[model samples]
Target chain A: MRDVAIVSTAQMTNVRREQRRNEVEMLMPVVQEAVKRSGIPKGDIGFTCSGSCDYLAGQPFAFVSALDAIGAWPPISESHVEMDGAWALYEAWVKIQTGQADSALVYSFGKSSMGDVPDVLNLQLDPYYLSPLGIDSISLAALQARAFLEKTQYTERDLAKVAVRSRKSAKDNPNAQLAGDFDLEKLLAEPYLVSPLRVHDCAPISDGAVAVVLAADDTARNACERPAWITGIDHRIEPHQPGVRDLSESPSTALAGAKAGVASGGIEVAELYAPFTHQELILRDALGLDASTSINPSGGALAANAIMVAGLTRIAEVANRIQWGSIGRGLAHATSGPCLQQNLVCVLEAK
Target chain B: MASGDGGLLSASHIVEYPYRRSTGPVMGRFFAALRDRRFEGVKTARGRVLVPPTEYDPQTGEAADEMVPVGPGGVVTTWAWVSHPRAKHPLNHPFAWALIQLDGADTAMLHAVDTGVESAMQTGMRVTPRWRAQTVGSINDVACFEPEGTS
Candidate 1:
């Protein structure tokens, strides 16, 4: 594989409801900022890829509308995925590897505040069975949480601890929408929004966008003094229905992690796109991450989850840290579908 | 739509699939069975039966058409209690969403259990489906599930 590195990243997050600007307007500055920071002229970028959910935008081909933000005047080569931006980055990486493009732009956006976020997610299910039955995202996650707890030795108190640490850590993240210290006892005393999960255990429903730029080999060296090299990246998926697969474990994540060579080197920071507290534990175990890794130094999805954007944000977080000269290597994970049905793992390094 | 300069200008937007599709061979048979208040699963190469049967086996990716009787009754493998009902939920009262394993099937199905209270639900609990008064060729024909001994 060719040496591809993420040269720059930018984001707009922790917004509870972005009522003024539409997706295109929201993404314009974020994308522009990323392109500018990468030291590559916008016109010189070879390819572009975007990830966003049409259901969240409440329109067909919303991604095309979002292209207005990128100024496709010259009719640039572009592609899209109905998934998280992390997948978009994966596509851009593929484009670079295929020799079709050396430098590429990747972006993802989500505005869950525009609709009934949980119910909107139900539409992604198998229409004949799951969707018609009206199983919203939260209920599905709660069921998975129950199964995870039953199959493992963890309990609600452990989930409460994860929540407390996440929010308290978010206090340092200026872009985090939900951040603060909370007594673990008080959090445990909170009523269940749905049994097996309290409000704290769930991520805040957020509206946000993220953009990142990728350059391969010489282009990467020229674009930035220090690039977060994409040493390994892979994604895996399981059956569509939640019933057939074991919700207690994320086989997809483990498979992806192995393919991505996560265990090849030491990881200083990790960004796991776990929308729920129990899911963090499951992904941690699935990837075989130990105590040395600083998980989610930027507060993770539990602090500000913006659906399609959250996964890509995980990649951007690791890239930012590596570029900032703080961390030598890191692991980032992104997941989609109910009960972690699909997973993508990427390993970034300073070398 | 609400109008305000404080970013409150809002309009309701709804999304729907623009096309209607056939449920295919296996699910068509499953829905037909659902109309008569019968439960069935598709037998796969792995010797497992998947409820809400599909035309293709999840494990082997082979074509699946063998339908077998699975359940009107099943055991709750795992459950999440919902203290308050949502507008779109199958039940209006408190309930639990569970993955239930029918007696003869290897896999489970997602459904709601009208347990009436959180404390009434638990793993390994026996439950049975509650059919709708009006039988339609739809998955909704069986409204939800209830405890085995409940009326």
Candidate 2:
């Protein structure tokens, strides 16, 4: 595989809603910022890809409308996925590896505030069996949390601690929606929003966008002085039906981590896209992350999850840290589907 | 869609697939059984039965053959309490969404248990289907689950 590094990354998040801007308007500035930071001309970008959910937009081919932000007047090579931006980054990485594109642009956006967030997620369930049941995202995740608690040693308090730490970490992140020191006892005293899961355990429904620029080999060296080289990246999926798979253990995450070589080196920072507090523990165990690793230093998904963009934000977080001269090596994880059903892991190193 | 500032067009639209689709072989039998107030599962090559039967085995991807009667009664494998019911929820009262492992079935099926209170629900609780008086060969044919001994 060619040495591909994320040359530049930019994002805007942690806001409850972006009422004024459409997806294109929200993404345009981030795109311009990322491309400018890379010092790469917009036209020099060999490929462009975006990730967003049409369900959230409530329109067919909704992503096509987002193309206006990138200015496709000259007709640039582009593709899209009905998934998170991390998956879009994966596609761009594969394109570069295939020698089809040397440098690429990836961006994703989500506006969960437009509609009933939990109810909207029900549309992604199994139409025949699950959807008819009207099992929304929070309820399904609550079920997972309950099952996780029953099987593991963790408790609601442990989950609360994860929430507390996440928000505390977000205090410095101006882009974080939920931040500041939370009282543990007060948090525990809060009533459950859905049985085992309290409001704090769940991610804030957020609206935002993220853009990343990737350059391979010499293009990478020229674009940034300290590049966060992509050492390993892989994603894996499990059976789609939640009942058929074990919800407590993320075998898919473990598989993706193994393929991404997460355990091969010492990780200085880790950004995990765990929307729920309990899920962070599951992903941590799956990826073999220990206490030594700085987990979710940017507050993670729990602090400012923006649906489709949160996963890509995980990658951008680690890459940004590497570029800032704080982290030598890192691992980033992104998950999709219910109960950590599909997972992607990427390992980054400073060079 | 709300009207936006300037000339940019905005309109509210409800995106939905207002259409009917065939359930196909295995699921056809499963729903047909539901119409008769019965429960059935597809027996896979491994002899394990999967409720909400798929035409192909989930584990093997081989064609599923035997349609075996599984359960009108099952035990909750795991559950989460729904304190405030949504309009779309099966029951208006508080209930538990459970993964039920019916007798003779290897895999679990998701459904709502109308427990009325959170304390009434628990893992391994016995529950049975409460069928709709008028069945239409749909998942809602079983209105929801209720405590096994309750009327």
Candidate 3:
């Protein structure tokens, strides 16, 4: 496989809402900044790919309009996915591996504030059974959290600690939507949003976008001082129906982690895309991450979940830290679907 | 901090797909049985019965054509108490969204349990389907599940 490295990354400061600017307008600056930092001209970008959900936009083919942000004046070769931007990055990586492109641009955008976000996600469920029942997203996660709690020794307090630590970590992240030195006692005292899960346990519905540039071999060496080289990347999926699989454990994540060579070396940091507090614990165990590994130093999805973009942000977060020469190697994870149904694991190392 | 000179304009935009979709063969069998106040499942090659059955085996792509009767009563494999129901929820008052493993079925089905009190819900609680008076050949034909001993 060709050596692909993430040369640059940029993202908008996550907020509760971005009502004035449309999706395209919100993504334009981020995409420009990422390319600028890479020192790769727009014309030189071999391919462009994005991840976004039209359901969030409340329109059909909404992603088509987002292409305007990348400047289609010359009609560049680009593709889009109905998933998180991490999957888009995967597609661009494949394009480069096949000798189709030497460099690629990857971006994702989402505005959960556009409508009732949880309810909007309900539309993605199986129409025959789950969807007709009007099962919103949080309640589904609550079910998973309850199952995880009953099967393990983890309690509500343990879940609260995860929340407190994440928010504290977010304090250093300027782009995070929720960040502060939260009191653990005060947090545990909060009421449940949906039984097992408190509001703090859930990722805040956020609006934002993220963009990252990828260059292969010589292109990567010339673009940045230190490129976070992609040593291994793989994604796996489980049965779509939640009942068929074990909710307490994430076999798919573990399988992907193994394929991505997560445990082959000592990982200094890990950016996990767990939207709920208990899910972080689940992914951590699945990926075999020890207590010594720093998890979600950028606050993770729990601080600012920009729907289609948060997964990609996780990858960018770890890459940014690696690019700065702070860490030698790290793992980044992205999850899609309810109860960790689909997962992608990517391992990055400093060059 | 200062307020912006111009405030943003907004309007309500309803997002919906207004279309009639067929439930298809496998799902149609399950829903049609619901209309008759009965539960049906499909038998897989592994001899496992799947409730709210799919046309093909989940693990393999093999077609599953045998329809078998499942249950009007089942044990809750897992549950989450919906302390406050949303406007779009099946029930107005508090309920638990549970995955009920019906008798003779290998997989559980997702539905609402109208247990009123959150304390009344538990993982292994026995529940029965409460069907709507007017059945529409849809999953909602069974309004919600209720505690087995309850009226």
- Candidate 3: which stretches are off by over 4 Å? B1-11
* Tens-place lDDT digits, model 2, residues B1-151: 5668886789767687998888888899999999999999999988889887888876678999789999989988888999998888888888899998888888888899997889998898899999999998988898899989999
RMSD of each: 1.6, 2.0, 2.7
lDDT score of model 3? 0.92
Model 2 chain B weakest lDDT span, ten residues long = B7-16
Give per-residue CA lDDT, model 1, range A43-62, as digits (tens). Answer: 99999999999888778887
Q: Which parts of model 2 have CA positions greater than 4 angstroms off? A: B1-12
Point out the worst 10-residue segment of candidate 2 chain A by lDDT: A238-247
Q: List the residue pairs that clash in candidate 2.
A: B1-B11, B1-B12
Best by lDDT: 3
lDDT of each: 0.91, 0.91, 0.92
Please report how far candidate 3 places residue B43 from its true position, in Å. 1.4
- Give per-residue CA lDDT, model 2, range A191-214, as digits (tens): 999999999999999999999999
| 1 or 3, greater by lDDT | 3
Candidate 1 chain B: worst 10 consecutive residues by lDDT?
B8-17
